[model samples]
Target: MDHQTEVNVGGPRMRPVQERSDHTALVVGDFLYVWGGYRSISGEEIFFPSDEICIYDMRSGEWQTRPMEGDIPPSLSGTCGSYLNGSMYIFGGCNDNGHSNQMYCVNLLGEKYIWKNFTEGVESRPTPRDKHSCWVYKDSIIYFGGYGCKQIRDVHPNSFTIDEASWAVIGNALFRFWGWNNEVHVYDPCSNTWTEPHTTGSSPTPRAAHASATLGSRGYVCGGMENMMMDLHYLDLESWTWTNIVSQSAVPQGRSWHTLTAFSPSSLFLFGGLNLFCEPLSDGWVFDLETAEWRQFQHPHQDKPRLWHTACLGLDSDVVIFGGSRDYRMLMDTIAVLRFPSLGHCSDVLIFQTQPYSLLRLCEDCIGKNAEILEKQLSILPLKLLEPIQKRISFFRTAVQTDKKITCT
Candidate 1:
């Protein structure tokens, strides 16, 4: 096993350490909220403090730390979450103690944010687990797969339970360390109830550290840590069925802790993870939903290995990958912005005819004159597109007002 030791990477102001893995990052409006995850210092695993919230401005490429005020959960990593309505719903993660089955929500709309526990009195819920994946389908948050204890009750009528052979017995059967679970659990915030919906067809094997993303009415899952999986499957929210995508080429290999991000209606972006050999990966690929095909694409961070990282579709559908480990021994505090070509975006255009100051002034004047019209036009765009574009526009407005030379590439 590779050893881990903490480095003082948080700098002088001493905010929360960004060198983490298994943390959750979700872009809400103009900011990316990152929470949970852990790092090691002197061989001791240390979780990011639960008292502070880490946020990144999509427009500024800057980080902000704010005090967390709410029914805060313990510091945890391997937790999965989704942004819904005005709140961010978090479920299942592990800490020093053990895995958790609890569900909590933090309202981001309020001036004073408070974390609210939702599963406190719920008699039925998913088992305590970490490294699971969750998807927000309409009003419900659906989660699947993680390393946790066995489920005492049926999560679904036909919940794909773990096989007997997978369980590990310790101390003459005095205790049992459970294996991975492939069960799917759904939490409906409208009724505040948990239900397991029955589905047809084959499901992915019990696995953890998988990547999931939602597109339209389907939730797609790909590549996880059950001996490292390369298979891809998606659960149709409309039909409640699992459909597998078997491609002989162009797809990523067996890997874990990668990110699957749905950038467009017909495409998904996949990035860095740990391969079956437990080695960090740097390659990226795009999966086309319409054609059921995968294609390898070069990214800016192609040479930088990363696993246990969190990625979010940022401004103009750029994939923003935040803190994760480069290897088993070294975690990172860097953020890489990858603008994928699969989103039908034009290649970086270069301008050679104009002086920097004059071009900047032209842009500033145009934006200033059309500010109201721009706002009205952007109002009708979807949040995924609108938020990022607004951020970009704001960034452009700020950039043009400064003396810095603006270049696009």
Candidate 2:
């Protein structure tokens, strides 16, 4: 990875010192695409350009900032996104103007990615919202709790359904001030329509910035802030039944803007968020689905606090967390990788075989000799070499810091 090389992909080259919060990151094949976030520099809050995307090639350890064309969404933050089929769908975020209920899709299967606005002419849709949670299950995207203005919109009465218990909880509050919601709105691509699914059992309270992930037929939601929520709930997609999880083991505090990622079929990794007092947290936990136990996750970067960051299941099931705020005032561009022994097949000692500097030199030699052939082949290089290349790149990023003083570790 060449941290020093700057490549322009139409328009202005993206800043290298980028900071973000309320962003979304999704791993597609070997590349991780990051989009829709805001950063606070000094006192000004600047949302990242929605026309551009930051993509990280995991195999090559390279970062690219490319301009996106065709029906790009407005510069916004706190939007929710999900990956389905060969495209990524983005929905509902707030910009400088206000909130939106629009939905857009970017086709990743094609060589030239094009964003398509699919929300046009949609009669029934969720109200404008942000800080919501969404996950793709089966052929539809399950959109849950979000913070949005309470506006009564006409819905398809037959399709709009809610559990009796959830209706009692939400009742008339669905049409009140800028409020949080517990609505289960399902968007089916086939019909390009949004329907409020009638869920059963007890539904969680209306909240925002909560984390959600799907494992098999179940969708799990944890930690959010309406009144600083700390509950855990899952809706069985097959049955549309909500079940609140009660853990015998100690669990992490209630938080909003945290992330819950399912690293495996039976387990999930939960990380940083804001507590009841709105303070950022750095703790990590792993929830076992079989036993319904919460176990503390031990890693080196526990002291690093982050919230509103995007965590994706990277190669080898490692949790790749990127760009969030530490204090809600100061945003960050830091990327942290957390490895759990339970999720990966390779051990730490064997993951990186040679020294960082040496591995990079060998890769450069391979590319120099065969250019085209080796450049493409570099992505498939042994994991032993790939790991250290990342470490080497990190050293380059951290050495200069903001002071520009090169410090050797």
Candidate 3:
């Protein structure tokens, strides 16, 4: 578990494992499954409304492709899918004509794909949507905000239980926050309901196209774009409230359309998306819940900057990041795996010498002048104020550089 080195796992050096062109991915068990998407063919970019499903098994380090059986749902992008209790449920993506309202389930154990049409009588079925997020919590599939024909709508979040086979909207009025409403909806099958708790202080501006993951009872919402954001937010299910956790080090840029995944209960990871300037990002970061801090992990062998990519937690403590759009013109098939650092062994550091020098040099190129001033004040004071000032300085640096890059061409 080396913290600095990045291993390729079993994918192409330049591209991710699966390279079809247009397809979105979902991960379940030990394998990553990708379905139909559009790609370039001949001279023009063509949409392949395909039922071809490809699987990359992490354990075996092999790739397998299979045609979806039965009447497959039309090929679409932005469709959300998740695995629960040995089944994968997919819902709501856009086709060539308009948004899709179809729901389908694949029984991983039974090896069968089942489609359910929810166009008829239902309390709500999430009006035609694509680019929304869906997660299986308890026994229900919960869906959040996405794009429709005209505008991106943050409709009342909806859910569908396996037993009832009907859609029900939740947290309609109790949880109200305005702006870009791309939320990650999680259902507690035990309560048979969905909850989006409110966050205190300044919440990450309402954003769509972000990513989220649940660890134990808490759900983490990270890197998304409203106008611009590089911060992280967490929803404590037990507390039913959102808390903006200040990042502790230099972090990735404010990005949307990225992926956040939970590998273990204490470890969360994020990778690849477009920044506020619409430039693609290829870096990665990890969050430690115990420390309540974020650490940027350098991937020495990662793919190029990309947005709209997908990532998932794999076996042992490995995270898999897959295909995404490099730019409007280029789509990617690159994949990278991140292994967590081992915390058991302690490193021995020989004490050298300590001296206080000009603090001005330390803060010379610092982004936030006010923050640097505070840091200088705290350094001379007691240790109690040092922690808070250090935290603020770290966050300021991250917020400034997350997407500010100087290109020398």
Candidate 4:
């Protein structure tokens, strides 16, 4: 059996903006942008109409706040946003008044933020809805699955190409499957269309509220409620097929309203959501693509069981989890990081490597156990040409010491 070493890379740290509540967070380049939701104070739920945008610097661990400029969309929840070409496009959220069909973009081009409204092209906008998933594929923003007024509308999976300045429905009109729409949809900017290719095996049931992450030519969807589902599925972009991979025993309890992030093709992390009973959860799970397994991570802090919170992978392989509801009240400004231990050790050596950053971290972990054996088996010239293995040794030492220094948050 292989020996696994688990290490807590950083002590518990919270962001300063704990006053403003939010749900979804997106990491674009070096900045982490978080948007608005309801705030809770003194047992009262306060709906914030303020268009406040908070930016966190990954390198410095500092935060800057700014008012959303121009025609600000109304405050809402269950909306989705993605960053592309140094700008962010936000669409489809539900406010107390009703679902919004409005789409807006924040251009991060200059020091001053510029917000552009797409109301002039209102005829091409998607129907007003909430709880949909949106992502950027090349130059287009692809949106899929959400709650409509009477029933969930899966009929209108939409894509917008900024270059063409047009919105078009892609794929045949399919009924919205309840739960998380774990289906994988991609938009090619060049073609200005969506493709749902036929797969060989059985695909996951149509569901909503689940999470997905894209790695290279493949996308993974996992851990969402489909009446009673607790497993995972993946779509190979090249083959256009779906495969159900068996999850390991320590897998998370069946959940919904959680978040998944693809730090690399092999390392996907899921954080916080509600169980079948509808209770909030804090346990974290890491899905290993190489092994096709899930490993549960239990944090010392039980205070942050956030459902409907947002998570995004950082440049250094750190996963940042931010605001969700705690005890039915929206949590403002609460944040935590699950640092990938291997990042600090191998980054200097693999500086020119083309692999995604998360893969390097996994390689460090996989090789740690057999370092001595590997050193003896490989030829001297090959070993000499390799990056110094001493960093791995150093990492083990620090990890052992840090493991002994575990403190609760």
As for model 1, its CA RMSD to the true structure in angstroms is 11.4
Between prediction 3 and prediction 4, the one with superior lDDT is 4
Candidate 2: TM-score? 0.75
Q: What is the C-alpha lDDT of each candidate?
A: 0.68, 0.69, 0.51, 0.54
Candidate 2 lowest-lDDT run of ten: 341-350
Cα-based lDDT at residue 112, candidate 2:
59
Q: For every model in order, what is the number of clashing pairs?
A: 2, 0, 5, 9
Lowest lDDT sum, 10 consecutive residues, model 1, at 337-346
**Total backbone collisions, model 3:** 5
Error of 4 at 112 (Å): 1.5
Using lDDT as the measure, name the better of candidate 1 and candidate 3. Answer: 1
Candidate 2 global CA lDDT score: 0.69
lDDT of 1 at 386: 58
Candidate 1 per-residue lDDT, tens place, 1-409, comes to 1111111113223243356667778876656777877776665667888867776665544455766677888998888888888788888887767679888898766565678888878977887888889888888899988876654443332334443443433312534335567777889987889988888888887788788998889988987865455889999987889988887566678898788888878888888787877677878888887787889865455546777778887645667677777765433211111101111111111111111234544454455446666777667777866554554565555445542222321
**Tens-digit lDDT string for candidate 2 (191-233):** 8988887898988877787899999999999878654546789
Evaluate residue 248 in candidate 3 and report its C-alpha lDDT on the 0 to 100 scale: 68
- Could you tell me the lDDT of residue 97 within candidate 3? 60
Cα lDDT tens digits, model 4, 1-409, are 1101111112223334543333456776656777765654554445554466666554334455666578777787667777776676777666557667577777654455667766553343555656667555547665554543323333323321111111122122332221223334444434434454446565666555667677666656665545376777766655767788886555677887778887665788787777887677767777888887788755553545666667787556667665565433223211111100110100000011113446655565445545666766434535543433444444444435434211212
